[model samples]
Target: MENSDVVIGVIFLSQTIFGFLGNSFLVYHYLMLYFVGCKLKFTDWILQHLIVANFLTLLCKGIPHTVSAFGLKDFLDDIGCKLIFYLHRIGRGVSISSTCFLSVFQAITISPKSSRWTQLKVKSPSYIASCVYMSWVLSFIVNIAFPMYMTARWYNRNITRLRVFEFCSSVQHDKTSDIVNAVFISIPDVLLVVLMLWSSGYMVCILYRHKQRMKHIHRSNFSFKSSAEFRATKIILLLVSTFVFFYTISCILQINMSLTHNPNSLWVNMASIVAACFPAVSPFLVISRSLCSACAGNRIS
Candidate 1:
């Protein structure tokens, strides 16, 4: 058990290091844009919020756990467990908000003259601040008591073998409290999924409309505006699609574990890794926009 955990720990440790370096470069680059007061023309102020949210997601999930893995220390005392889990939950919530907001922003940006949101489009930036604020507040409200529901247990004392981080036990509270926790957790998940699905469908619709329009127009070449927007849309779609895919699977595994009672160490660890991978991989995937742009137009077809 120790041997297997050690091997996996080493691998995740590497992921932790690489994720940090990449996100660090991204954070620095975006900060330069913010500091220089660069007019973010093609995009809007929301990109700043997205970048910050991604950075937090990566930092919270990747850094401390890496340290814990390398030290071969669970370090999940009561306070420690609560703090780590709470912060990571916040990061996770913020990520969902940022991604959903990105989708809506893109949809608004590309809305046609006949669209209902056209008036909202006129003052898009004005509406964006409020939406992002609401996203944060909504996420915070839903997840505020998450830490209270989780308890840290010494792995050997509670189970056959030790695992990374202290094991977490859940509510022995009243049925009402348990129901509340489940509903609170589930509400955001459902809402985010709906937001992402709607945004994705909306983006696909716009892309198809653009394609149909292109067929009639002079295909002289790609205009930079059209090219940039299309590529950005593709990248955002890919990120959100990946998020939804893995997120759905992880949620299923969690539910399965909940219902079935016995989740082996292997299954438990694998589920943890699967859930963890989405947030870690998301930043790099988003940043890869630059590399793929040269071929994005070709791929878009």
Candidate 2:
């Protein structure tokens, strides 16, 4: 156990514990909202699924990296490696898709009545559950090849062309196969990220126009600052920015890893750490928004 590895393990442990607790709190809060007969919005359903996916992502990726970082050997068998990697990939895909959906939904929700998105804004809520389910199904279908390529790390054999992880090793396919697989795996992610960015831009334009319109009517900066619209916009941008920043870093690392025959363990650990950041941080952001909304509702009532 090198000192650096130990430090990485400690970091992973902390992220896993904090992310689990934060997501668990969110899960409990939503369950209570349902049980208390509170009317949940369509976006609430998407958020519920997103939190679950985040927990899944943290658990599958974090625990293994932590165990491996501490110099644990043979912790996972072949079946375990395949199952964990497959599930982690699915969780990641769902997180990406759900975030895109949420952003697009919100953009539509806030669009002016005469805008082109008005029809979608009216009809979008009803399909939230179906959209979430389809994302899971598509993710599963797309990543089904992962388990076939993954196996437990072989200690005795000297594998020359394998990309070894902490507990698992992926077989390096031939060039044509590798290109095809990469394309299939990355297409959905690329599409989702594009949609998310587009919707985020749309939201920003709407917010800017809204602020300009409000300035003439209110004539008070404090009133605009205190408004729910401003608060919600701020939260959305923060969430989207956090997701994109960490996600982009992880993607770059992943690309670098793919281009190398033997990926560096340090690079792997760094990628995992960045990958876990959004999931770990996002729940606290949502919880803050929830608390704020609750306070505002109380004052209103």
Candidate 3:
């Protein structure tokens, strides 16, 4: 009933609604493209998975936070908490994996034919589905620890070792089990982040070299700016940078929370907002890029 709670609730509600609509629009647009038999780039498939994962993440992370912020409680049972937490983890995992894969795929796509990655570029599109499938499988299998530990939040409040959420609580595990689970979770995340950074750096280097070459060949700067490949690569770079920025902030907040023996709700809510930033903002970026591409095509024709 507090004004602060109302404001928080409205913020989360707005983010969830806008994110869902934007993602839905992209999904619909892609489906229409498929039905009309339009020629689609292989990267489009990776984006489809990303969009879906974003949608899932928004719903799972947003609705519960929104509801709790409004001071509603006890709506979720044990099963509900377990399912929501499990799905949210899976969605987050898939989102990270998909972004990493997309970055690597785009880097390969734009590599020169003479480069050592030429073989990978040629064979990569065929493996897109397999990679997506594996991401989903790995996400599901790795987060099984979540469901085992999650329970509906209890009002009795007798437990000291539980990690309490708005509607769910995680029972603390033994130190050994916790270490093992953390290792399994952290390793994949670290690998994906490293791959993303490497691929992004590679793309930046290629773009720089291309720009220098273009400077010698063309008097007008517009030639490089007007390129479709340039625009596409720019969009991917924007997405990667946005994701990394928000993900880093979220991780920092999480680490701060873990260092505190009893962190408050504000830190938790702030972390959730930071985590949701990329999902809420990324759809608009892609939509703008798509519109720009269409306009460029028309201009060329």
Candidate 4:
């Protein structure tokens, strides 16, 4: 088999394995969340929205491509390609938006009395539903143009040179397409990164303040609350950090791949794998925190 075959094979195996594992666990956890009588609190609602989005991401995009990589029937004809890519892009756009919402929600949840987000903190499940519904609608509206802009094009058999997979490719980026794509992608990415950065920075600042307060109180210079909360915050921080890192890497690789050419390039697929890893790990990390043994113990007591 050629290196292309080998590369695609490994890529398929990894996608299948990760897709199965991630989506299966996400489904299980979602079911458990529903069945365990855990009221769909605001944060829980956010998590559910995220889980649903990630599941869609994996299903609409990951699984079909995985099957195709394994030599499954090319069921995604022109129309199928249009719909699949459109829906997949919508779901992924939602994923990014939902994540931004999560970070903002968390920051608001932890806001001090002086903060302006305090008012939103008083809202309950109803507001949660409204926000989540808005998120879905916003995501859909933002990405609806994807299908409009993308069309299936068969490479002319005569053209000896092309880029990427030619069974379907966007026509050269026009002014309208360039504007739409940039607007859609940039807004969510910018909002998410900004929220993530602000929340993470605020957490560190608050932790610093608390540590100083502890030292002033105990005079011991060692603080248990600071240590413990940092541990919890660190988990969430790590999840966000890893995602940002991998996302940056994937984006850079995509830019490079577009500018350069190598059908045999391993980095291109590696970047896809990296981008896929975030959704794979995000849910379990959320589950790990939400369903902590301490919370379970508190319930028992």
Candidate 5:
């Protein structure tokens, strides 16, 4: 391998290992919590599912790229390519949907008791579970056409190529199928972005109002409820903001790759790296929050 390739391989391997470990830690932590009979909050359930999705995403996207970067060519066969790409897309979709659900659920949870949104809090757990199930079903159904189109070079002898890369390629779809696929992929992403923004904005407003109200109260008489809400809102905002940043960059890189018709370009590697950033970083944020919360709880006791 060239020096540049080696460098890329090292970076990719490091990211894959870090993301895998972080996500694994999150999954293990939550599973232990469950087995120990600790009652999981609604958001905790969403978080556990998100961790699994992110871990799968890292594995599916990162492993192949890392292998290729290390000079291992054609590491995956046609079926393997299709399966990895399909599962990666599903995992990405689930992560987006789960994060959106988490934000909306928290928004509802922190709403004023008199507000209509707050009334849904009682049913939030059921709503979250239903949303998670629907997201998985929709992702699986929509991406079924993926394996039909995807193949490694060995399997492409009889097919008209849509786009060719060193790693994998897909057959060109007809106009209708292409449009349908585009819409299918775009809808969930667009909806999640909208929901995340609205929920984040609403939470920000709520936090601002609470801060204003607190200015009139004595410091010693501050409300623990307000503090907890503030912490939750801050964490959610941070997570949403970071996700949007990385996701937008990744999307831009992907668009560049598609439009340029060069799947082997450095942009592809960059896009994978950018996409992996969120999964690698998000788990640490959750761990930090959990540790802080635990410390705070212990102090209070």
Candidate 6:
């Protein structure tokens, strides 16, 4: 393999390993908490599902890309291509949906009891469960065309114009079909982005109000629950902002690639790396936040 290929392989492999392990740790930790009879909070339930989605995304997307980068041409057959891409799409959808739900849930949770959002607080668990189920179903339905449109291809060093990965290529679709698929894939993402932005904004307003109120209260009268909620909201906000930043960059690069018909360009690779980085880094962020919160609680006590 070329030196560039080696470098790409190394980067892909590192991302895959780190992301897989981090997400796996989260899943294991949460499952253990459940088995030990600790009650899982609504946020924990959302996180557990999010970790699973991230883990699957890293595995399904990263492994194939890594193998291809390492010069394993035609490693995946047509069926393998379909399955991997389908799962990756599903995982991506679930990740977006779950994050949106988490943000909205927290927004409602922290809203004033007299606010209109308070009603959602009581039904939040049921809504979250239903949302999760619908996310899976929607993702599956949207990606069902993947297998029918994908085919495995052997890599040819002499061919310079083919921009797809060495292992698989998507069959060209009719213009109408292309438009329909694009719309279908984009609707959920657009809706999720809108929801995330709205929820985050609402939460920020709530936090600001709470902080103003806190200024009037004596330090000795501060509530630990409020402090914890503030910290958790901040973390979730950071997470959502990070996701939006990365997802936006990735989407722009992908759009550029599609327009230029150069999916093998370095920009495409960079997009993939940025997309993978969120899942890889998120688990560590959660773990660190949890540790810091625990330490703070102990110190306060």
Top candidate, metric lDDT: 2
Clashes of each: 0, 0, 0, 0, 0, 0
What is the per-residue lDDT of model 1 for residues 1-301, given as tens digits with 9 covering 90 to 100? 3677677667667666666666676667656655655545434355556556655655655555455445544556666666666766776677677777778777887778788988878787667678788877876777778777555565225533322332454435554765677787888768877987997899999999899888888767768877777878888788789888878887888776654444665565556666666666766786777522233223211
Cα error of candidate 2 at position 251, Å:
0.5
Q: Point to the candidate with the largest TM-score.
A: 2
lDDT of 4: 0.61
Error (Å) of candidate 2 at residue 246 is 0.8
**Whole-model lDDT per candidate:** 0.66, 0.83, 0.82, 0.61, 0.81, 0.79
Worst 10 residues of 6 by lDDT: 292-301
lDDT of 2 at 247: 94
Q: In angstroms, what RMSD does candidate 3 have relative to the true structure?
A: 3.2
Candidate order, lDDT descending:
2, 3, 5, 6, 1, 4
Deviation in Å, model 6, residue 134 alpha carbon: 1.1
Where is model 3 more than 4 Å wrong at Cα?
155-157, 219-226, 291-301
lDDT of 4 by residue, 169-283 (tens): 4444545756667666668767767877888777677667766766667557665544544555666566667667777887787666655533333654565566566777776
lDDT of 3 by residue, 1-301 (tens): 8888888888889999989988888888877776655656667778888898898789888999999999986788888888888888888999998989888988988888899999987788778668888999999999987798888877336478787766677777676787687787878988999999999999999999889887777566556434777668879999999999999998899778755545677887888888787888888999977832242222211
lDDT of 5 by residue, 265-286 (tens): 4777898888888888898888
Worst 10 residues of 1 by lDDT: 292-301
Pairs of residues clashing in candidate 3? none
Better of 2 and 3 by lDDT: 2
TM-score of each: 0.82, 0.92, 0.91, 0.77, 0.91, 0.91
Error of 1 at 251 (Å): 0.9
